[model samples]
Target: MLSNDWAIEARGLVKRFDGFTAVDGVDLSVPQGAIYGILGPNGAGKTTTLRMLQGIIDPDSGVRRILGADRPHDVAHRIGYLPEERGLYPTMKTYEAIAFMGALRGLPLAEGRRRGKAMMEEHGLSYAIDRQIRQLSKGMAQQVQILGTLVHNPDLVIFDEPFSGLDALNQGKLEKMIRALAAGGTTVIFSTHVIAHAERLCDEVAIIAGGRVPFAGPVDVARDRIPAQVRLETRHADGPWRAALPPDARHEGALWSFPLPDTGVEPLLRALIEGEAGILSLSIERAGLHDAFVAIAGEAAARALGQPTQEEAA
Candidate 1:
């Protein structure tokens, strides 16, 4: 694995399309061997930021460093990029397609072919290696492209919605491969609108909204940014304890959710006991990253589009 150090850095990054800013002033830092997740709703500039980082698009203003290189082009051969949209030559065989992509990044033809073959086997596409891209299943085709992205063994890898068209089985495989990449010292930055994927795989995450970052940090740290709200089930449904909760607390059926200002599991328990709320079952329903993302991005969307937030819409 890569040594524990900074692998990617960006500061005051800005990208505009005509008068519309796709990415506003933003800062990002990803550490070596880290599976950093970039999360946001659609049109929130996640792809724009990633494109700038990959040198597919230049920022209007801002600086980016990849693997100690000031310019992404300087380290182009050392990084692999998988855009949200895909490309494949329908006439080419899977092996041929992968080899061509690797070769474009300067890998020797022989090495690319060898690595491509091995990857096909590893990803369960060995039987389809000789088949033309047009003949393979959509899942098979996607795997072929994914394998192509990794054939050259890049030190830094970027994937946009890597799990977009995957089913549960292939999604599991991709998750395993991502972990393996980090284990082997690759710095992975992937963007996805799915919160569960990032919660399960990312060591650190950035939640973006309206082309701006609202929260960025380790998963546990990001959890802290949202208040702790829990559900408690008491033995006595009609207990007087309901009267003890603050007026702001919510009651749904027999479950009570008290929104604590901070994450204090012990004090929450103590407060329940002090209130004489017979705790038959107490489940901490901490606000998920999705909830937090919606809280931040939804508000921005409200202002940007002059529309109600999802909650307000509901």
Candidate 2:
């Protein structure tokens, strides 16, 4: 039985557009206050999943529970969503836009304005609060949108490519804010093609391909799927005994690869000593989440969506 304490739960969720399936069967569970991440290339159905979770679009099949409530049915008040595409009234003042979003989430107009001003000051937007969104820089505009997303203080927050358009400094700032939100007991489900940000910010992650999850778990568990391989260079090129070892060693040219069971250097060290192959250089190689994503999901997924293994839009 799944705990009622979970912020988001889905069982075999499915979504379709006309005759085509946009999101295939998917099972996801997000614990309360987790910084969960959905990673995929373009058209992987991440946005569709978020839309369903937020009740913007109903699912064609399966189950979805977000923020302790069934979506597209009841309780739109407990969720905050930041879409992949930016949307802000060009003529609206930054503070007004944010407060308006808060009001939509059920906060009173006066309280929403107070919170909006506080967030603006907290995020270094105090100077731009009165300015029209059209006059702000792209980075500042993005910040305004983020403030709007959080103004309601929803229990569940969904961010689709939150870092789409921003400088390095702004991206870093957003990352910090995301971490802070999770720490403050907000269940944050964010989708990104950027692998580094996911690796850094997420407690758990789901990697989607072809609109389905192929990998979902902790980062270390995902990393464990790929074995470690080391490349060793010998001092001599044409030494005798180019034969293979019982441990399955391969040699090409002067380069030798003695696949160790893991990162332990002792076995490889002993093998080199026994082989009488003079060692030139030895380096330990561990596969990163990016390599695992490519190896598991294949090159097509990588080609279709060229994003960092953790952070795509960023």
Candidate 3:
């Protein structure tokens, strides 16, 4: 049984297509009023797991509870789901489309339209409310669909690759909207292959690799799996302080970069000063979600996914 404090709970979820397994014994727990993310590469079974949670597809074996209900339909009206594939009636007016989606989720047509108009006004899309979906720009169309998903004011919202196909400006807007949703006590779960998005927006995250989840926890905890690093630059490269440098230190130009030793930076600073090394600069770089994902999911899997590394993103 799932606790009332949890918005979503899944146990031992397994899904197979023919002889190939898409998800293998996955478990997930999303707390109420939290923004959770599922991070994975393409074909990493992220969509499969989300589909099972929404009851769009059944797991071959497992139990899932949404809003404390064992059956999805029992709480269908409370969930707002934006699928990976965007589906909107191209000929329908933006406001009409939003109201129609809300109607499907059990909202009355009149109430749906009223809420849809309000949402458009709030999102600065009131000017485009009567425009046909096909007439809107890609970003506008995407935003319209998202507003539709929220028209009924669902308590739990799930977005699959919401950042995909969006420009940087639109991506920033979506991120703000997601944060606002969580702040308003909605449990927001999103799946993204982009580590940076997950790092910036998620309170907790689950990393999926090759149909299995190897790490699931707070974003800071994930980042802690990798060590912190320090980059030092000095005029004297071959001084007595060299002995104090870590074995993995690498020289690039005048800078020496290496992981910060567990013993701490104070000892290294003392050694450098004692050796009279002219310290030009010393900076510590903390490991981020991208580093954690690469460390936990393995470099090979990360490479195969072709997602940008943290350094590259930076």
Candidate 4:
């Protein structure tokens, strides 16, 4: 049984390559049995941070703990890691490749092979057990690698860009697999720049930009950073209510849009009614993760990273 409340923790993490600082004072607190996401664009130091947490590379400063162990190597057997790059032997049979990964993590060859076969059967890949990896499709090959990562049944799993090369259907499958892992009491952490995946899959997320975290916490909290918006359309475009509208209000044809005030929309509604404006339509638009990302990371940064500012997928 795990005694620690947090599955992974890091503080003041700093990684410097020569004079260039890749990661600067980044901190994280991931809860047990939860799906957490480390989000950032390419070259934003996400991989460097993950490397430090997994003990593949030591941080220049700060401390890290994984599965209640201060030394990552001490709990290596309890953690399963899938790096961004796929390195399975092309000539190895699918089952052999999975069993080999488990063996490296301390499972005996016979037990590893047994678990590998069971895992493949459970995931609907039993038919490919004897086929060489090179003969499988890209998606199938990636799935095999993921199964290998879990062949030892580790308590915590870390994936770097798990959805990178997957098609929409395969990405959906990976998302369901991640949720299933968490439901079965595994702490799952994955890094991705795609806000949509994090929005759909993570219980909590940390937004990393330029080697710094501007926001970290529950997904709802990040979304709450930006106020809701109110869009209104009236028959009288030149009505007195137009004067009552906020300065930021924008007009496009008959529609006027602006951020809903923190005080609420009651005042605006009353003002519109009093001005005798013909209310054609009025609706509130809640901010989503994409909007929150833009609000926290800046529109320019979001654009430069090729992330959509609106709810639309990038």
Candidate 5:
């Protein structure tokens, strides 16, 4: 037994295939009822790590205790998983598909159907409850799959890239759903390449790149790894106050930007005032997850941050 407080505990998990290491000594701990995120770019081993955790694929090495069990499948009945590669019988009615999924998790078919019908009605999808999967819109199909994943009411929920293929509106709905899940004390673990979603939703996160975890912990902690950034707009760009700026500071026209000084901003503020440097505006912003990822994952990993993934391109 895992003391009931931790939903998952994994240590030094490793998986390799055909001489290529897919996950290299990954470790993760998820507290019960917390919203945790695995963050990385596409092909960064996010899916592999999630698969290992789900026990869908065994790791070449390492151990895991999931939902108080030594093996993942031992507690499978208490977990809900939605994989990135989604599939549902195209001919199956929406409600039947949800009931089928629940049945796989040991829910009785009748109860599953009842819950499925109520859930669809609650989500304002009653019209699609009887429609076949083929006839529903893409977003609607995805929604049905999500409902299926939850039909059994699993305590631990894992969604691998749930936001992929969702438009802005649907994405917002999904975010709201995740929040509701967490609010109701469900332990939610999800993987995503999108930084904004992770930054906004995750209380804790693991940053992965090239099949390796570069940093893992609280989101604020990861962001604090880099000093806060400072942007300054002034009437005059150069003065004795400029000397107070960090050596790496750069300027374009009247705007200067740099990392905040370790000595704090008081000295710089005083210098600007005493030197009569006209400070038009000054702002300090803590480093976001994007900046922290770049700093931790290095240039090679950072290159992928700007490139649109295949899902976005499509």
Candidate 6:
């Protein structure tokens, strides 16, 4: 049975295509009003899993519940989805496009139009209000589609690669919009190959790789899996305190870098000062989600993430 506190829940979900496993057994739990991120590299079955969750495609096996409904159809009108592929009616005016999108979700055309124009004004897109979608820039067009997705003010919103193809400025705009949504008590779920975005916005996340989830919990928990690192720069390379440093400690000139000492940094700091090593700088850094992903998902997945996307390559 699904819990009332959860907006989404899935268990042992599996999906296969043409004898190839696209998504292996997967599990997820999303709180009622959180910004949850599905983090993974390309070809990691993110889209497939999302499709199954949306009831766009049935899983080969397993079960899921969306907004307390076993059948997503019962609450389809209450959810908004922005697919990886973007499209809109090019001939329609910007506000009309947004209104049309809302209409599809049960808003009246007149009410949708009124709300759409108000939204455009609020977002500084009022100048494009009367302009046709085809006349807008690619980024502007995408913004229209994004506005359309939220025009109905759905309780749950799913965005697949929402940041993909957006320039840095526009990407920031989208991030602000997502934050506003969460502040308004909406549940926002998004998938991205970039871990940084998830680290910044998500309250909780599920790290997926090779179609399976290896870790799912608070962002801090994911990062805390690896010990904090220490960067030490000292005048003297050799000292009695050197014994406190790990064998794998990296040295370049006067700077040294390694994981924090098992006995803790205080003992080492005390020894370094007493042993007469002139400390120039010392800083400890906890592992970030990017580092956690590499540690949890492995280097092969990291390579896939580092590869430039088509937009970047262009």
- Give Cα-based local distance difference scores for all models: 0.82, 0.80, 0.90, 0.89, 0.88, 0.90
Residue 92 lDDT in model 1? 95
Best by lDDT: 3
lDDT of 1 by residue, 1-314 (tens): 22225788888889999899889987888998999999877798999999987778899998887888777788889888888898999999898899988998889988888888888887777898789999988877888888888888999999999998988999999999999999999999999877788988999988777788877888887776677776777866764556556678777777777776354667667766877777888776666666566675667654443344546753
Residue 123's lDDT in candidate 3: 83
Which residue pairs show collisions in model 6?
none
Model 5 TM-score on a 0 to 1 scale:
0.94
lDDT of 4: 0.89
lDDT of 4 by residue, 145-247 (tens): 9999999999999999999888998899899999999999999999998889999999999998888888889999999998888999998868787777889
- The local distance difference test score of model 6 is 0.90
> How high is the lDDT of residue 276 in model 3?
77
Q: How do the residues 1-314 of candidate 2 rate in per-residue lDDT, one tens digit apiece? A: 33466788887779987788889998788889899999888899999988887778878888787766764446677788889889888999888889888888888888888888889998877998789989999888888988988988888888999978888899999999888889898889999888788878888888888879888877777777777767888876644334323357667877766555553778657766677778888776766777777766767787676744323422
- List the candidate 3 regions with Cα displacement exceeding 4 Å: 308-314
Off by over 4 Å in 4: 1-3, 309-314
How much is 227 displaced in model 5, in angstroms?
A: 1.0
Question: Across residues 1-314, which tens digit of lDDT does each residue of candidate 3 receive?
Answer: 55666899988899999989999999889999999999988999999999999899999998989998999888999999999999999999998999999998999989888888899999888999889999998889999999999999999999999998889988999999999999999999999988888888999999998889998889999998988989999988687888889888988978888999898999999999998778999998999888888889987667766866555654
Error of 4 at 92 (Å): 0.9
Q: How far is candidate 2 from the true structure (C-alpha RMSD, Å)?
A: 3.8
Q: Choose 3 or 4, whichever is better by lDDT.
A: 3
Whole-model lDDT, candidate 5? 0.88
Give the Cα-based TM-score of candidate 1 against the true structure. 0.89
How good is model 4 by TM-score?
0.93
Clashes of 1: 1
- TM-score for candidate 2: 0.87
